[model samples]
Target: MSEAPWWRGAVTYQIYPRSFMDTDGDGVGDLPGIIDRLDYVASLGVDAIWISPFFRSPMADFGYDIADYREVDPLFGNNDDFDHLLAKAHSLGLKVMIDQVLSHTSVEHAWFRQSRESRDNPKADWYVWADAREDGTPPNNWLSLFGGCAWQWEPRRGQYYLHNFLTSQPDLNYHNPDVRRAVLDEVKFWLDKGVDGLRLDAINFCFHDQQLRDNPPKPEDKRVGRGFSPDNPYAFQYHYYNNTRPENIAFLEDLRALMDQYHQVAAIGEISSEDSLATTAEYTRDGRLHMGYSFELLTDDFSAAYIRSTVQNLEAQMLEGWPCWAISNHDVARVLTRWGNGDASPQLANLLSAMVCSLRGSVCVYQGEELGLTEAEVPFEALQDPYGITFWPTFKGRDGCRTPMPWNNGINAGFSVGEPWLPVPAEHRALAVSLQESEPGSALHRFRAFMAWRRTQPALRLGDIRFLDTPEPVLAFTRRHGDETVLAAFNLSAQPVELPLDGIAGATPVNGHGLAQGTFADGRLSLPGHGALYARID
Candidate 1:
C-alpha cells in the first residue's frame, strides 16, 4: 500500500510571527526569534508549523498586503534568516508552511504602480481597472471588505481599480494570462526555498467577474458573518460578482501541478464565500487543493449540535477531498473566550484540545491556545488594526487576539525588551510559559499530553467518523480505521451529566492524558463539566 501524505491527519501549529517572540529587541517577532524557539514548538508534538505572512509589505494589512513576494520584510529579517529558519525547522522533524497572499497586492507593489500609471503601460492590465460612470460614482455598488466602495479612483489611469480588501490592497486581474503566470512563478520561488507547504491566503478571491455588476442586498436573516460586525456595510450585500469566480478552479489545477513536482509538498486553500462549505469542497476535489478550510468552525456558534452538523455537512459534500479544521486563528477571537463563555480554565482548555483533534479532519492549533490564553483587552488608543479603528466601541477589532505571546512575567512579558508592537495583557502575563512550566496541571502541560496521546490513536488520526445520537449537551462519536475503532465523547456544558452507553460493548478506557473527571458503571457514563472520554471498542 502507498504511504499516506504527511498532512493527511497532522496537527499544524499556527505561529503569528509578529506576535510569537522577539529576539532583536525590535518589539516585533522576527525570523531569528522563530529559529530560537523551534525547540519549544517541536516539543508540542505537532507535525508542522504554519507561519503567517512575513513577506515584504507596507504593513497596510500587517503583512497581508504584499509589495514584494521574493523579498522578506527587513523588519522580520533578510532572505538568509528565512532560509536558516526553514533548515532548522526541518531538522527538528517539523514541516514549515508559509502564507501566500496571491489574490491581491499592496498599492505600492511594482506591478500595481506600473499598472496604475497609464492605460498604455506594459503592466496596464495586470490589475483590475474600470472607467467610472457618467455620474462620477464608483463603477458599481461593490463594497470593500474594509468599508465603502471596492473601486478606488486612480487619477493617473483615468479609471477606478478593484480592491476587495483595503484600498491599499488592489486585486490582481487573474483574467490576464500573464497575471496568472506571474503569480504562479512567485509561488514557485517559495517552493524552491525548501518549504514543505503553502497556505494559500484568500485563495477563492483570486478571480472576479469580468463584468462589474452591482452586488444584490443580502437578506436580514442571512446577514451574520464570522469576522465582521453586523452593522458593517460590507455584510449587507450578497457579494455575487465581487469574488468566488469559476476561473479559480483552473488556476488551482495549475498550482497543484506545480506542487506535484516536489515530494510530499502540500497546498491548503482558505475559502470564504456565501456558500463557503460548497466552495471548500469544490476547491479540494479533483487534485485541485490538497486540503481546504472555511469559517464554519471559526464562528461564534459553540454547541454539540452545531459542531456535529458542520462536520457532517462538510463530509457529505466533500466526497474525495480532505478538510482542515481550526477553531481559532489570527483573524478570529480566541476560541476559549468565544465558546467558553469567558472561561479560560485548564479543564476547559484540555477538553477543547482533545475534542477538536478527535474530529475527522486535520487540525490547526493557534498560537497560545495551549496556554488557554484569553483575548487581550487593547484600549482604543493602543489599537493598531485598521478594522478596529473603522468600527470602534461598537465592535472591537481583532487587535485583542493579535497581542504578543507571553513568555515570562517580566517586562513586556518576555516578548521583547522594547515596547512591543501590541500591549501584552496582564491577564495573559499571569499565564506565562515560565509559570506553566512549573505546574504539572497547567493548561500547557495538559495540551502537550493530549497531543502526544492522540498521535498514538490511528482511529483519531486517520479514520471515518460516525457521530452518535446523544443528548443536547453531550457529543459522542465513533472513529473506525481498519481493525481499530475508538469511541469519543465530550460534555459541552458546565453541569455534570449522565449518558447511557447503548449498543457499545467490549470497550476499554484509554488513560494518561489529563482529561476531566468521568466514570463508567452499570452501562451508564457519568461525566463532570467539560469532560472528555476515549475508549477502544472491539
Candidate 2:
C-alpha cells in the first residue's frame, strides 16, 4: 500500500489556458499567465496540473486541433515560456500534464496540407482518405460529433477525408505505421522536455474502421447520454465504426511502451464512444493507458442512486485498471449548474468536490470549480465556440462553461485588461478569488481546506470503497486501507435530512474540513442543507 504510484488516487487540477489568466493583455491566457499563477495552484493542494492544449492551431476548435505538435502557439508565447512555466511549477511541487491531441490535426498542418494535395504523394496516405460513392455522396453514414457528415471532400485528391470532429480537424491515419511513428515522436518531444503526464484528448478516436462501415441506428430512448443531445444527428447512431475501434488497443499498447521509457510520466485517456464506461475499462486494462476517464458522472443525473449505480458499474468491471474521475472539464457545463440544478451553493460545491474526491480513484478538478462558478449566459453574437454556434438555441454548445476566470471585480474581472475572448459573468466576479480568500466560508476556502485535510487521511486517499444502501438524497460509503477505515455520508439536497446507520451504527466524528458539517449521535446522522459527515470507523 505504501508503494502505490503517485498518480493512484491523486488529484489533478485542470487549467483551461485561454480562460485561466491573460498576461499580454491580448484577451487570451498564455503560458506566462499560467506561470504567474503556479503558486496559487500549489496552494490548492493538488498533486498535478493538467493544462489543456496550447499547441499551434488554427483556433477552429480552439487548441484541440493541433497544427504543430512540436512548438507552442505564438498566441501562448514561445517554447521558452513553456520551459519557464514547467520549471516554476516544479519548483512549487506541482507536476505538469499537457494535452496531446493525436487523433486529428488541424487542416493547416503540413501533413494534412500534403495529404490533401494528391493521391500518390508520400504523405497522401498519412490521413484517412476514401473515394466518394458513384453518386458523389460521402462513402458512409458516419456522422461528425460537430454535426453533418464526417467525410469532407478534397477536390485535389478526388477523394474525401475523415474528420470525427470539426472539418478543420482532419483525422490522422493510425493504420499507417509512419503516422503512428510521427505521432509518437511528437509525444516523446514533450516527455523529453520534462512533462509529468499527458492528457490524451479523444484518444479512443485515433483509429477508424478500415471497412468504412455505416453505424447502426440508435433507439430514441438510448440516445440520451453524456456529451450527446437529443437534437444532434450524431446521437442517432450507435457509432460502432467511426471511433473506439478494436485497432486502438494495439496503438494504446504502443503508446504505453513509449511512456514506459520515461520516469514516472503517466497518460490519462479521455474516453467517449458508444459505450464509454466499457471502453474506459477496456482502454485502461493491461499495459494500455495508465488511467482512463469517461463522461459518466458529468451528466445531468445527480441522484444518489444514479451515482451509486454508475460508480458500482465501473468498479465492477475496472478490476485490473485505474480510473480518474472528473465532474467538469473544458467540454462540459459547470458541475455547480449541472448537478446542483437551480439551487447551487458554496456548501453544495464543496460537498460535490469532496464526494468525487472520496471515490476510489484519482480526481481532476476543473478550473474555477473551487470558486463554485456557474455556467455563463453568453449571447450568441459573442460566442467563439463553433460547436455552440452550430447548435445555437437548443444546445448552446460549451461556451457557457468556457468563459474567462474571474480573479477580481475589476474590468474583465481582472482576467484581462483587453476584452476577453468570452465575457466574464457578473456572478463570477462576485465570487472572485480575491473576495473568496477574504470570506471565511467561501467555496474557494472550503475547497482548499478539504483538499488539505484530505491529504492527511490515508484511507480516504488510497482505500477500497464500499457503498452503503441509503435512501434518496443520502449517499453513504466506507473506505478502508490497512488499519484505517473512514465512513462518509452526504445530503445532496438543501433540505435537512436524517439517515439511520444500519449495521455501521457508530462513528467517531472527524471535523475541520470546512464543509457544511453534520452530526452523528445515537444511531442517526442529522445533516442540514448540503451537509457532509466523515468519521473514523474504528
Give the per-residue lDDT digits (tens) of candidate 2, residues 146-191: 9899999999999999999999999999999999999999999999
**Candidate 2 deviant stretches above 4 angstroms:** none
lDDT of 1 by residue, 94-188 (tens): 99999999999999899999999899989999999999899988889999888788999999988999999999999999999999999999999
Local distance difference test values of all predictions, in order: 0.90, 0.91
TM-score of 2: 0.99
Clashes of each: 0, 0
lDDT of 1 at 259: 94
Clashing pairs in 1: none
Every model's TM-score = 0.98, 0.99
